[model samples]
Every structure is written in structure tokens, then in C-alpha cells.
Target: MTDERETVEYDSPTGGWGSLRGMVQTALRERPSAGAFETLRRQNKAGGFMCTSCAWGKPKHPHAFEFCENGAKATLWELTRYRCTPEFFAKHSVTELRGWSDHDLEHEGRLTHPMRYDAATDHYLPCEWEEAFAAIGTELKAIDPKSAIFYASGRASLETSYLYALFARLYGHNNLPDSSNMCHETTSVALTELIGSSVGTCVLGDFEHCDAIFFFGQNTGTNSPRFLHPLQKAVERGCKVVTFNPIREKGLIEFISPQNPAQMITGKGTEISCQYLQVRAGGDIAAIMGLCKFVFAEDERRGGTLIDRAFIADHCVGYEEFRAKADATTWDRIEQESGLSRADIEEAGRVYVAAERVIGVYGMGLTQHVHGFENIAMLINLLLMGGHIGREGAGICPVRGHSNVQGQRTVGISEKPELVPLDKLAEQFGFEPPRDTGTTTVDVCEGILDNTVQAFIGLGGNFLRAVPDQGRIEPAWERMRLTVQIATKLNRNHLFNGKTAYLLPCLGRSEEDMQAGGPQTVTIEDSFSHIHGSLGHRTPASEHLKSELAIVAGMAMATLPPNPKVHWKKWTGDYSLVRDLIAETYHEQFHDMNARMFEPGGFYRGNSARERVWKTKTGKAQFTAPEMLAATNVADADGRYRLVTVRSNDQFNTTIYGYSDRLRGIEGTRDVVLMNPQDIKRAGLSAGQRVTLVGDAGDDHVRRIGGLEIIPFDLPDGTIVGYYPELNPLIALHHHDQASKTPASKAVPVRIEA
Candidate 1:
């Protein structure tokens, strides 16, 4: 299998015929019909289902074709012709299907019925919805409330997530872990502590008027193609883009809009990055520190006129602490640590000085690290130094990875009681929520390992594969007494059977949601504050499949005491009631969720930062003092490479579209490590040589990923790149950001065994 696949350098820009070709092929294989294209036309449109791909917002004024290649694939994959019914499960046991890859499992098709694992045969047998809910209730009643963990995915809508929070708490457990803990946990931790809210301050419209954009640790071309449009427009208006990453991603360099007819005809792509700096893995803090030093030097040279003196005096705190940290750090230290020259760092500062309004964008590259929280605080320090936020076209933007992950958090999927205040919810729902703290994804994993968590119910995600140190975590996962997953398709997590397991199939986002109260439209929050109404019009894969909201409500109804304080059935059948309850719970922000959802492009969930109103502990936008990048996580041995897990253009999170990574110019394999030519030659290995990648995470567990082919590519020294989830095994379960508890998947120190 490794011998059949070969690497090829893609000469074309990101998103032209290559995007079109990939989109068409994926769609044809999944859902080959005229109806499929029609359904896609509504994707990200005025009143259509939001694509469960990346959470890049729909443009306030969208183009004719707003959907990207990956977005099309994401929705169409749900609308596939194939369906995995009861007969399909009866044919294969969990043991027999253990060898199948994640890609193959998903491609098998959408799940069509509820199933329970029969331990005798090691196979899953179909069960009634009532039976599944009863089973969950029986297990919950048997186990201690503290022993249960409820996990949520990013794609969960506001209504469903709100109910999930209520259900988990009412059933007497405070353990609520969500997908953000796996990806953008640092962003939330930094922003929530440093500023007030975890969500970004900027809106989607900021791209048009922003003078400059600094893309740190993000590849815009592939992860967020819809964002490229405004970025292209920004470039046309002379907006400079500066990128800091370990690899030269084609998207960050140049992007041709596949939706633009003129660009397609002319074959000319827009230049994306004015400057692209290849900083090493785990070097984000130092790189950001370099920018801060330059900004401070220029401020002194210009006699403080370069910074917003008035804004700083009026609305910020801790400027002195931030300045002191910057003053103590030297340029020589910055250069050595950031892997960039002093001149390049100053050049970045010069661009910042020239632009009046700046927009800073980042991704998991900055978040999933040992010092990830510090990395974000430093970026905010740079932004606050210039008084960039709290104004038009100026704020921090963290591109989210899923459809409604932001929305889910907004409606109370947080483990922190402060974010989802128990007092406020109790007043709204006539029930008091637990004031105690809950477990995060990392915490839940530890809980499972210690046997503290006996039951886990997932609300729409492949929980096992989405987490780190799966090799160690899976064994603990198997020890659980009861495990339940509410999903649209089959995933690896379903194979991990516990004493009792249930896979309850649910409706996808692109399917018709007709209920007792008539058709319903769900709302989702984007990377920005925009709320979009998603309406699905297609027929479901099976008559047995239920909506996520219904499934969640069913479980709540079965578990909670009879004649409960909250009416679960009334709200489940009528989504408006759920929206009404959400609005009541969060009256200040979502006072009229149902009414406002009907707006043409929906409305923005109010952002205080956007209005220059800080809501932090000090009631001001506080300037944070961040420490120097920690070298503690880096391996001590010489000639060791730091391996960062990355996503392929063809994939979305844990779902692998194919083996191809078109944006990075690789093809036909996920089990390949991208390495610097110098490092490759130093190890006495050439391109396509197979080697075992071993990791040292300061633990007793031996971490190794074997049989990975090496591909000599454009990566920084002492750094290598591998596909996400596949490389997740190398990351220790304990390895994570200290403050946020986010897995440090971006900075695993390793050596290649040839």
C-alpha cells in the first residue's frame, strides 16, 4: 500500500480546477444526483443548512457560489446514497470491523437505526428508540451522578446543546466536556481570562476595511476558503498579509478563487502573503515576542505616537507589566528562538505601523502547544499595544473548525459554571444547576483512566479519535460500564464497546426536520458573531432516524423523574420553546433568538469588545504579561525533530475525505511524514523512506508511530509534519497546555527510527 502512493509537487494555486475536480469526484461518489447539486446551491445561502465543515462565516453579502470544495463534500457526504441499516450491522461484528480505517468506515454510509452491542457475538444489534433511551436511563440510575460524563461536539446546534447542559445537570452530573477542548481550548482560556468573552471581537465584514492582516499559524487557503474571498478583496485594496508558520502552505502564499470567473479564465491567482516566515514548531510564543519587541522599539523611536496613547490611558491595564516583559527580552534571543532574522521581525513591525486598522488571525497552530495560552496572551499584547481592537476592522479572529461549535458554547456547553451561570439558568428553567466545576476533555480522559467516570454519552462526535494519546486512552475507554453515542454516521468510537454500548443514529444537518410542530430551522453561530438560520429540505436516509434535538430530549425524558420541572416533550417537538428558553437563559445576548433567526442573513450576537466596552475583572481590556516560550516540552536529545499534526485539504477534523493533501502538494497517503531536506539527509534517509516516529512526552508510556514514509519537503529545521488523528497516538494523554488543558498536538518532540 505504501509503495503504490507517490508524492507530487502541485504547481497550481489553491482552489482552481483542483478544488473543482476534488469537489466533483467526492460528490459523485457520495451523492450522484441532480438533487445533490441543488442542495449544495443552498449551502451557506440565505436560508439553507449550514455546512458542518469549518465554521468560517457566510459573507454578510454572499457571492453566488458561497460554498467551498470541502464544504460541498461535508454536506454531500451526509446526503450519500448508501445507508448503514440493521442488516449492515448484523453482517459484521465490532471485532471484524476493527481493522477498517476511519475513511473507509465513514464512506460505508449514514447510520439508519439505533443499535446496542451484544457482548456474546461482539456485534451490534438494532434496538428501538425507546429501548435505547431506557437503557441509558437504567445505567444512569445505577451509576453515581458524579460518575457520568456528557461529551458534546462543535456541530451541535444551540437548542440541542442547551438541552444537553440542562439534562446533564438535572440528572445530577456537572461533567460537560466539548470538542473545543481538543482544538481551540487555549483561545477560549486566554480570551476569557484576559478579556471577557471567549468569542472573537471582529465580525466577518472586518476583512473589507482592515488595512492589514497577520495570519499566525493558520493556512487560510484550505481551512477557510470562504475567508479567502474577503482576503482577496483585501489584497486588491492593498492590505498586506503576513504569515508565521513552520511550513510554506500554498494557501498562505497565493490563492485563486474558484468562484471568480475572471480569475478562472485568466489563470492568475491573487498573491496572499506579502511575507511568509517559517517559524519552527512550538515557536509561536517567541515569534509573537519578536513582533512585540519590534513594535515597542518603533514606539520609542516615534516618541509613543505609533501607539494609541489615548486609548491605552483610558481603557487598558497592566501595560507596564507587558512592557517590562518585552524590555527584558533581547532581539538575539528572539531570533534564535523564533527561527527568523531580526530584519524579518522588524519588517513585520513596519507593516503593522503602516496600517491604521489591523486584524490578527490564528488557528490551532498557535493554540495546541505547551505554551499555547501564553502564545495567545502575547498576540493580544501586541494587539493591545497598538489599541487595535474595539474599533472597526481591528480585532483578534480565531478561525473555528466546525459548524456550530461556537454556538454550542454560547448556549451552555462549557464545563465552567461561570460561563454558563447556574443562577441564571435556574431562574429560567425552574431548576438549580450544580455550582461545582465540571470535567474538560482532558480531565474526562483522566477520569476514565482512574475509573472515576463510569458512563459517557456523546452528543455528535467521534470522541475517541478526536482526543490525544488514543493508544493509552482507548484501554481506559473500554473499561467504562456504559457508553452511548448520538451520531449521523459510523466512526471508530462505536467500535470501543464497554459493558453496555449504544449507537443512536440521528438526522444530519441537511435533512428535513419535520416534527409534531411542523418544519424547524436551526441556528448556528459562525467564527464571527453572525447567527445563521439553517434549513434542510432533503429527505432523510431512513424513516427510523430521529433528529439530534429529539434524541437528546428522549434521553432526558427517560432519565429525569416523571412530571419534571421542565417540559422536555413540549420543547422537543416545538423548537421555538427551546429557543425561547435559551433567550430567557441568556436574555441580554439572545433576547429574541426565534424572531431574529428569520432575518435575511441573521444577526450578530452582540460583542462588547466591538463597541470598546471591556467586561474583564478590571472592566478594561487588560494587557497580559506572558512569559518566554517554555523549552520544557521540547526533547533534550540532539538531532530530534518536533512533529506537528496537521490536517489535509481533503479532510475535515477526524473525517478523512481521501489520502491526498493537495494544498501541501502531497498525494495518496496519510501515513507520511513531511520533513526538511537537510534533516532528512542528516538521518541518512531519502524521500519515500519508511521509518518509525517515536515520541518522548515526559511519561513512562512508549510512544511510537511506525511504517511512516518520509517525504523531503519545505519544513523548518528539527520539525516534521504528519496528518492529524493518525499521528494522535504519538501525543501522550497527559501532554497539554497548562492553563487550557488543550492537547499539545502541535509540539510533540520525536526522533525518526530508520
Candidate 2:
């Protein structure tokens, strides 16, 4: 008999263990012993850490080992055995490390000590913690704080986020650009316009009571595998789950519950969505418009309580204007714009009409466009028409990407909106906060390009890789006077040259944070308003590494003079003190944060909109009609396809854990772009042909990548999909959402050539 291991080609996409099923089988075949399982169980429950992969909601009663494949990889990465020591850095120069891929940099292991890049030696030399902190403090103090940017990552705990915001305000700058600005800025912008709040109105319990679910731009199966259970429960209860996305994901269509014993044993999966619609890329606004048009028309014809006339009259404003505009939209125009038949839209409207309680869930796909805000607003309008708000199982749900990103913004991580937050900063901290609006993520890059931003302190993030226009961003990063990164592991952002760049190794969430006194617990806010406590399981990987909260406090203490008015050092030792300060500074919702967090599944932040109590000036939900704009990209006579950048199942934003995209049948490669077979034939190109894609006009932005076999897909005419970071160079920096300054990553016009 042939040896199973010898017969398997582990490296090859097809010949080896490329398939997800095959990978799973191999993993089980070479399974670790019971001791390994026990260790994993202990580590998973340890106080301070949460899964770093997808922001899938945590189960109320989490299993001993409840993480997914990507989640496990992220956990192992954080709890890795390897270390990036001074000796390792001495052996490799900056030039040598710069040539490393994202995976290679991370695989080199966790950073063991604080290091500063030496231009002469082109190497990262170890620096003492005190010296590193002093250098960062000096650089920050030198810059006009308004021009200094403090960027946050999603992985940061609430304690760290609150401290970062406090430090930024204390330093006289409100230029707090965070990861949320890139992902969910549109959701915040839209929700505020419609309901006077920036958060989702639904909790996990709301899913149990929902009659119908309209999911858009998110693949719950891969992005948030934990959500599959709730979706499966909803499906079992006869709830209709509808999907609207550019790609038909398997997870959306069918979900195999890892926790379900019978289903797992039988190798059977639960059907997730009752209906799946493959909407065109950047066509969400059009699809939403079409749905509204159909609903309004149906309501008018049905008459007498068909529309929520009482709710519209009593609780909402601008319905007359919205109704008129929606009525004016023609069926033919809707079909032309959305690439969906009028019959299909009306059928979806029938689902909404039949259900008394409905919820709409969306992700970054709905937010990363020029008309993202409008797209979300339209969905809110749909929910309002059916009187879905303020009821159980009915509201707008924006599936946030980062675990704690929503909480970060909730605790005041923004460059705009100068209201109570600024006033509170002055009243509490005894410093007049900068009134002038500061730079956002896009604005920071623009400021860097214009030579205005002198210093950049990234609390935690891969800014260069995350931002658009890679060609311009690389040079702009190098131009900064000083760049400081507080990170646990090495990433591509560290390679971006600066006159003075320092990498300070910090403690991961999974590690214990024992300060001068004792063990510590950090806080995180879920997709809903509920805040929960987290404690670390394992000992600190290195004694030199500090908790994010301590690092922020240390930097603040080193930079600012002693102020008798405010007690900054007290917050460094205990997170509860910081929470108390937060309550005092922002008296809205967090007044009892300290007392409330002690309870299991902490209290809701109290969204007025969720209770049908609008906080807007008029005390009513308002609707605004946005003018429909023509397609930004016009096809050239040469028939170049419009290229759109998207994420794969195995990837999370800029972090590529692996190269296998199981849903799309893409394995071990990121070079191929999914294209319709009709487009390939029309362009006189065959499958597996190497092509060079170029932007319109004299923009020298071009990407030369090979083509894979053309699968006859359902993508709309004049559209193509490819992976981001690689394709970001082709998208112009100026093409962005005007309202929020988010890059129009969803829509970029391009021509493919052989």
C-alpha cells in the first residue's frame, strides 16, 4: 500500500494538499496528542486575549477550542515560540529585510526588544526602553501636535484606545486616524444622518427574533465564521436569509457548523440563504435604489397601511421628498443601473413585504465606495418604510471588521466632529483642545505628500499597505521627520523608510499584563454596545515588552510636563482608573462603565435610535435624497475591463495568512484576476494568457500579472475583480468618497491587454 504522506504533494495547489478538504484531512491525519488539545483549551480561555482573525461575535458559552482555521493561525501567530532578537537583527540589514514578503517578515518571529533603524548601517539596532521612549517623546514634542498623526489598529484593547485618545488630546492634537476610518466610516456617516447614532441597532439576541435577513457585501462564512451559528439558527426557524454580493460565496450559500455533532458526523451543511443575488461591483447604490423603487410602487398600489404611514408621519421627517424621488426612478433605469431584472427586485420586495421584522447587515464592501453613505441610507429608508426600527430583530447591522474598532470610535477616535469631546477635553484635562479639524487616514497621506505632516506615531497598524496609491505613499512615508511604530510583530509598514524610525516591541493581548502591582484586565466593545473584560492566559513572551496601555502612558509621561490638574500616572497602573476618567470626561452612556463591566455581557451604551428616541435636532429620523451620479469610469474603445480590488476568504485586509481562496477555487496564488469568459473572448484573449492592465490617460500605473482559466461567471458586463495591495497602485489617490474621504476602492476603470 502507498504511504499517504508520500503520495501527497503538500506544496502544489492541485497535485498536493491544495484543497480545503484535503488540508483538513491531512491535519487530522497528523493530529497532535491530547496534551496539545489541553494546552490549546487553557490558552483559549486565558483572561486577556481574543481571536485576532475575524470579528465574528464570540459565543455566549464559548467552546474550549471554538476558533476557526484563520482564527487559529492568528492565535498561533500571536502565541508563537520564535523571537526576533538583537542577534537576529544584527545578522540582517534593513535592505535585506525590506526584500522580505509580508509572510516572511512575520514568520521571522516576535520582536524581542525595542529597536531603532540606523541609516548608516541599514540595520535595526537594539535600544533601551528609556532611550526609545525619550526619542519618541522628543520627536512628538518637536512637531506642532496638530500635524502629528496618531493611528490605531483594531487589535488594540479599549484601555489602550482610550489612553491613545487621551494622550492625543493631551498633546494638543485631535488628528486621531484609526483603522475604523478605512473600513466603517461610511456606516458611521450613514447611521448618523438617518438616526443620529453611528452604531448598529441590533444585538445578537435580535437575530433570534428576526423574520428575514438581508445581507450585503459580507461573507459571514469566512469573514465572521461565528455568525454562521446565528444564521443557521435563523434559517432553522424559517427565517429567510437573502444575500447581495458580487461573488457567490459558499459560506453564504451553505454553512457546515463545526460545533454541530450530527451535522459534522454526517458531513452535511445547513442551507444559509434562501436567495442569493450576485450584484455588480460598485452597484450597491443602484440595487438599493431599485429595491426602494419597487417597495414604494408596491405600497402605493396596495394602499391603506401598505406603507408605515403612521410611523412616517409621527417619527420621521423628509418622507415626502424621498418618496417623490424614489417614485421618479423608472424600472428600465433601475435595471440598466443594477444589472438585475425588475421582476427580481419586486420578488425581493415581496420578501420584505411578507416579513413583519427584517434586518439588513452590511460590511466594508458597502462602505468602500463613493456612494457608500447613500447605499446605507437607502437601506435604512427601506427598514423605516416597514417600521423595522425599534422592534426586536429589526434594524441596520454593519458587520464591523476589527474586534474592538467600533469601541475605539465610540470612545472618541476621530479627526472630525468637534462637539462635546473637545469641550470635555478642555474641562477635564485643563488644555484647550485644537478646534481645527485634523487629518483623517486619507488626509494624513495627503498631508505627508504636501510636506505638512512632520511626525507619525502609529500605535498599531500597517498604514502604508492599508492606504491607497502605493506608488505615492512609499515616498511620502520616507519624507517624514520621524516615524514610530508600537507593534508586537514585524510587518510591511516597518520597511517604509523614514529619517528616524523606531520599532518598539509591545505585549500581545494573549500574554499576561502584570504591571508594578498585579494582573490586569482590558476591555473591548462588541459589534453591539456591550463591553466585555479580557484577561491574558500566558506569561509575557519577553520581560521588556509592555502592555499597550503602559506604552501609551509611558510615552505621555515622557513627553508632557507634570500637570497637577490631571492624574495621568494613576491610569497607567489600573485600567479601571482610566475607565473612571472616561466616564468623567464623556458623561454620555459610559457614566457607569466601571461598575457595569463587572457584570457578564456588560451593559449597552443606550442608542436613542434603537428605542425610537431620535437625538437629532428635530427629534425624528430624517431622510436625505442623494443625486444619482453616472458611472465614474467610461470604457475606452479598446475594451479594457473595469478592475475592482477585493479580499479573499483566507485573507483579512492587508494580512495574507495564506494564498488559498477556497470559495473562488484560487489556490496558492494571488496573481490571477477573475474575469467573465465573454469579456476574454471579446478582447481576443485566451485562458492562462499573461496580460498588462493599465489605467486611462497618461497615468503610468500598470500591473503585469498572468491570467488564469476564465470561468463563466455572473459578473456584470464591463467588470473584473482582483486582490488589493497588489492592485492598489492602479487606483488613483484622488478618487475617493467626498463625504468621508474613503478611497473608491470598489470602482476603478481599467483596460486589459495581452
Best by lDDT: 1
lDDT tens readout by residue for model 1, 1-754 = 1221333356788888888999988977786434777788888877877888989978656778789888988877888898888898889989888799999999899898899999999989999999999988888888888889999988878888888988998888678889999989898888977778787898877887899999888877778878888888899899999999988888877778888888898878999899999988877788888888888888889897888878888988999888888889888878877888989888988899999999989999889988888888888888887889988889999999888888888888888888876887777667767888889999998988888989999998899998888888888888899999999889999999779999999888888898989988888888987888888888888899999999999998888886445888888779889888888888888888888885655688888877878878898888877766642266446857788898899888889888778887777788898887777777788788889998877668888989998887777788889988899989887778888899988878877899
Root-mean-square deviation of candidate 2: 4.7
Tell me how candidate 1 scores on lDDT.
Answer: 0.85
Evaluate candidate 1 by giving its C-alpha RMSD to the native, one decimal. Answer: 2.0
Superposed Cα deviation of residue 679, candidate 2 (Å) = 1.6
Among all candidates shown, the one with the greatest TM-score: 1
lDDT of 2 by residue, 593-654 (tens): 77776454456677778999887778889876657722233433457565678776656767
Model 2 clash pairs are: 9-16, 47-535, 47-536, 48-535, 48-536, 640-751
TM values, all candidates: 0.98, 0.92
Task: List the global CA lDDT of all models.
Answer: 0.85, 0.73
What is the TM-score (0 to 1) of candidate 1? 0.98
